[model samples]
Target: MAAAEVSHKDLETGPPTGSEKHTNGVGSKVKAHRTKDAQHGDKDLLQNVFIGAIDAGTTSSRFLILDGAGTPVAQHQIELDQSYPRPGWHEHDPQQLIDSVRECMEKATADFTSKGHDVSDIRAIGITNQRETTLVWDTETGEPLHPAIAWPDTRTQALVRELKEREGADELRELCGLPLSTYPSAVKLVWLLRNVDAVREAYEAGRLSFGTVDTWLLYHLNGGLEEKSNVTDATNASRTMFMNLHTLEYDDKLLDFFNLDRNKLRLPKIVPSSSPDAFGKVSEGSLRGVRITGCLGDQSAAMVGQKAFTPGSAKNTYGTGCFLLYNVGEEPVISKHGLLATVAYHFGRDKKPVYALEGSIAVAGSGVKFLMNNLGFVEQSHEITDLAATVEDNGGCVFVTAFSGLFAPYWIDDAKGTIFGITQHTTQGHIARATLEATCFQTKAILDAMAKDSGQPLAELAVDGGMSASDLCMQTQADIINIPVVRPAMRETTSLGAAFAAGFAVGIWKEFHELESINQKGRTVFEPDISEKKSAKMFKKWSKAVEMCRGWSDEDEDDASDQE
Candidate 1:
């Protein structure tokens, strides 16, 4: 079938086409409908066909219900409780993750029904979650053996250093497209096996199951122990350091490097990001009986949501951290410039999977949070942009926001947060502006590295997430990077991407081109407002700051050693 060409107004107000029909899972024709209310006009009209997206992110769990047009009709979100028992450790209660998702689904569904919609209209559900956060569980009891080791946790930093010295350590990147770093699931899994008794005992008893956040959500959402839907998509699996980049499967050699036994430990089955039956159905909840058809890591989902299907299309998400993913087409391009190669998405079992080069920054919105919570510059994160706008410019100040350490392109593990060119004239506004510019500088670095690796210059950058909501921040990003920054009016592209995947599986939208008008209505484009030479000069000063900031943490470590 040819892709549909619907207008944004038509999609929002009425069906795509008159009497347009699509078949659901059971092969029954589902027609779009619009009923008018005497009091509310088109407000009571229902699409009658919908998709649900379960977005289990790092800080929160969100459920969004989208119509065929990709507009989020109803949604609910809940912040997750985070635990940090040690200095470099971060964890989450496994049950809280599950409960949060369930509550979101229930509440979102309630909101949908209250809008004069039917629950039966929701055909399929998709899931997108935080990548690389490791979870281990007892297979028999289906209880988590340990607290979920969060992706940002640095407890494995010492372990990573030790592993880098081991033989065959240098060869891992060629196989898995990831370096021996503290981010991947393999390192976190190894840490748990060595440090946690419950995890080790479960592993020894042949009852341990290892999974990322996506797999953990799938297992419980599909009826927990009864269904045991232990599976992960390629996008999430690619971040684990266990999955082979070429074959998209777990490698035995990679397993040997981590001293993992595939026989004893239960690994989630790897599946395509968009599949009709691979992920199984939602066994219970407000979404009970709906087939769970799509899954992707949050970044990958954002790429899909932005409709960045063409090669050379790139996106930058400014959340707690910043992730820049550049699409490299079907074949994976192993980065020679410190970027990680990852699966972009796999729509079906037969179709070839697309790949991307990813560059991650350790801090973006967190830098804003630090300014709010740590420095007391503002009452909320969004206010930082206003504070930044008070200053005409950075006033010769540069803030290297390496709260934990720099990541991607630089990978400077020993660097600490530093403010360079700070003078007595530096005010709170100057500091706030410099903090925002820190993310922009890192994004420019990653984009440069991506161009070097893929041999493709980015024409523009599509951006979303919490930090992207600020016009000043995005405008600064455009000025620094010298590229057009595109932000859609519907900023929940992560959830929309999951809905797109589920919609694809159920024939609601047959091809990517059908999504041409989905969320393209009211987009704000930030052009490069500054001169190119000025942007370059500003970046050069930032580069100098990065180099000077190195070894700051190393000096602190040395002082601690001397005291000991």
Candidate 2:
């Protein structure tokens, strides 16, 4: 729980076998020859290759040092101080974002060295961050012009409505692979230009620099204005609604549509997710001079971490919010469904960019957090699983978790969080079960949409993040989706993905096949237990609840307008 605490638990769930031999920076099949005096065995040889990953998430900044086997050697995490000045407005201090990362790196590096490992062995570092969080800074001074507008912030809701009616709005999605919504950085940047005086003035003066969290962190981590390592990967740039999905570059048409001048505003260069030289080195820290080789948006990194490289492979991350991404292969699929299309990851400059169809649920683990902190249903978040298990089923209850409106296929903005079928027979267990089922139902819906868009059914769902730790929840998910839910023993796949990217760029692993055994040990597979008829009945009831919950938020808005 402490920020500087170091976890020493063995992350590998099973004992190493004879086949799990060490590789000396070559592919997995080629074994490293051991010297006669090698005392630590494979682990000592593994110490020769380690990759560092900096995970800048929604609520925390973490640094993880992982071995060649994808096991974390040392790590440190620090919770971020989030500011919600008004409802639907989330902001983070730009300085604190990089500061927390630097501190985490220092602390994690200290832990790594204290364990008798050489810090110089950290061959390359990678960065994975929360995507679409917009930041602007002065090009001359390298100081943030305003607070970082987080991805979840809905401050541009009214602006989104106006933009949707604009002439070129309909064509925007086909070009950028994103709908005109409050989620993208383009709208956020437009809002700042219109409202924030400092940002507007800087933009007008041609001294403004715009970047997502990745670029901001890279700039500071690589020695700020002096080094000027202001660049973002294709995965992050794809979310900005400014980059062309096919070209992987900033589009002039998109800039014109958003009314942004390329001459006036300095945007970060779009680079491959895994490159040996694109991301610069850590300027001054415990791992100073180490090359930062790989970078990805968190979800993309998680996909790589899960090794979901093949087409039709899908991953569902149930964090504060749920994100379901289905790999559609090299070409980007412009979603006919309510899902968003985006780049999955691009390994190198020459490698063709892989794309995915994304479906975002506004509430997942946050719904569980509401149960623990708001409703006092349990003392801890994980206890909600225990409470739900007290009931065999939801007892005819269905919860529509639309706390800040639903996303993905439904796109129901006028619906609030609603629960239905509450009878005298319903108990806390029933509600708890329904709460867990809400995420599962949404995931099933997203997968259905993805199947429609890509013409490929998801064979198994690779899951991670906080909510995936619950066996009851994962089992429910498996039952509802009628597919196997695969969970790796090492759930820190986001960090591992970044490390893998860095490792790949530096030739620690030569090919994708070489990473097959890295984090595959002791994985759990939850099989579908319920009958298809039973699953269909439950899903139908959930659909009815979703329809019933519509217009609740709109009604509240109308009532407020009447009062005014």
Candidate 3:
């Protein structure tokens, strides 16, 4: 944990002075953006400069202030409520998200402001968020008509079922590179219209507008209460099932499929994921006047955070769930595997887009949440890592954390979470190790599918997110995949990724080479030390456990299936 606590200030790229150069992956030419208390006499060496980034995630929202090169100087974070109104229902107060954003910004900027940091030093803010969570509200008043429906909510299962029965169901996946799951916004929109009275009336009156969390926050953050500034990045727009992947605009077929009127519904202007005119300036609060310069779906930002821009570079984020993305460059490849084609980022309306092939696991960190809260295996999330480290191995146990069904590669939505290979000899340590192993197994499967679809064999995987802090889990990941697991010196990669996008877009920084030079900060590379034979043996056992977990409890399947 001490090793993980080190910051990556040493690796940040230099400010954009024109030449796009990088050395060993860190930016050079130290320049002060945010004041670092001039305690450094001539003898003290200068390092990174400061920038701001905000990351909106599923479980919480955080604000980070990074220096010129890409290391977090100070951060503020808050966890919001997760509402489960009923079985398979998940929601967040849209207003809560808005309030949380304001609060977090205040906290992160408090230190800078207190020290009398120059406002000019803070160039812009980059925004990254949980993709596909739906937000809809009145256009004029900026009031959410209903709670924001989260991506994990399966209340839209019936809606997804109906869509599948529609004529174009089969082609939706090929067209959108996404299956007709309850996760996307299209079905959620349908459910909201049917079930929520306010949504129905708003839609009928043509006063309703919808967007992902990024759009919602940006709308409010950019003076929505006073003026209209609502817009969404292309990456967020693509997940809505309404946008044409190639055209980067709303499609007629999708509108017809979801029974949505483009004009009636407020759609954010599609902007480049990185751009100057694309994002709005925060109108109020401590971050007031700070240009909102960058936006991307959280997963894409995670890939960027890992600096996986190079082809054949891959990353998997261990969060409430897990997502693996392989950077496929400018073109979006329609996935042959059960994965999705996504825009990594469009440098904000001007720069050509970066694309990725993504596969997700619906239940990664949430599985630990279950053991800690539901099953009482541990006291807190951090303790899970320590408990797992207690065991030399899983002791012939395996767990398929399918609490909410499997995602990516498998797409086994009907399956529930399961523990496999449990015997009388099994101990708590085995279960703890199995839980961690579960994350790695699902990650490997997703990466394999990603590789198959994108035609890129990853040489290494750069990982981040909450769970990536676990050394044991990272080592397991490296050993299982037979590739080096590179953990960045800075763990707050999400916020840094957002800052990078915003800074680059505004010319605070220029090319990837320039960003690369800011700093390489040190990295912990976990190599595959296990023999191939041993690796194969564990995988075989893990595979069998996965099969056993499938088709467990037909009654529950029937119940969940009947709801659809």
Candidate 3 accuracy as lDDT: 0.73
TM-score of each: 0.90, 0.90, 0.88
- Candidate 1: misplaced stretches above 4 Å? 1-46, 554-564
Which one is best on lDDT? 2
Candidate 1, poorest ten consecutive residues by summed lDDT? 1-10
lDDT values for all models: 0.81, 0.82, 0.73
lDDT of 2 by residue, 90-205 (tens): 78999999999999999999999999998888999999998888999999999899999988777676677778888999999999998887678999899888888899999999
Candidate 3: regions farther than 4 A off: 1-49, 348-350, 551-564
Write down the worst ten-residue block by lDDT for model 3: 1-10
Residue pairs of candidate 2 with colliding backbone atoms: none
The true-versus-predicted C-alpha distance at residue 373 of model 2, in Å, is 2.3
TM-score of 2: 0.90
lDDT of candidate model 2 versus the reference: 0.82
Question: Across residues 1-564, which tens digit of lDDT does each residue of candidate 3 receive?
Answer: 001111222112222222222121111111111112212222211123456877788778778887775656678878878898776677899988888878988888987766667556788889888888998898767788888888877665555656789998887765666788877888888788877788878888888988998999888888886768778888888888888777788888888888888777877888888887667798987777888888878887777777777766777777777888888888788888788887777774346777778887777677767778787988777677666756667878888887656767786665667777788988877898898788898777777787777666688888776677666677678888887777665667667778878887777666675555333445556667678789878888877777776765343333333222
RMSD of 2: 7.8
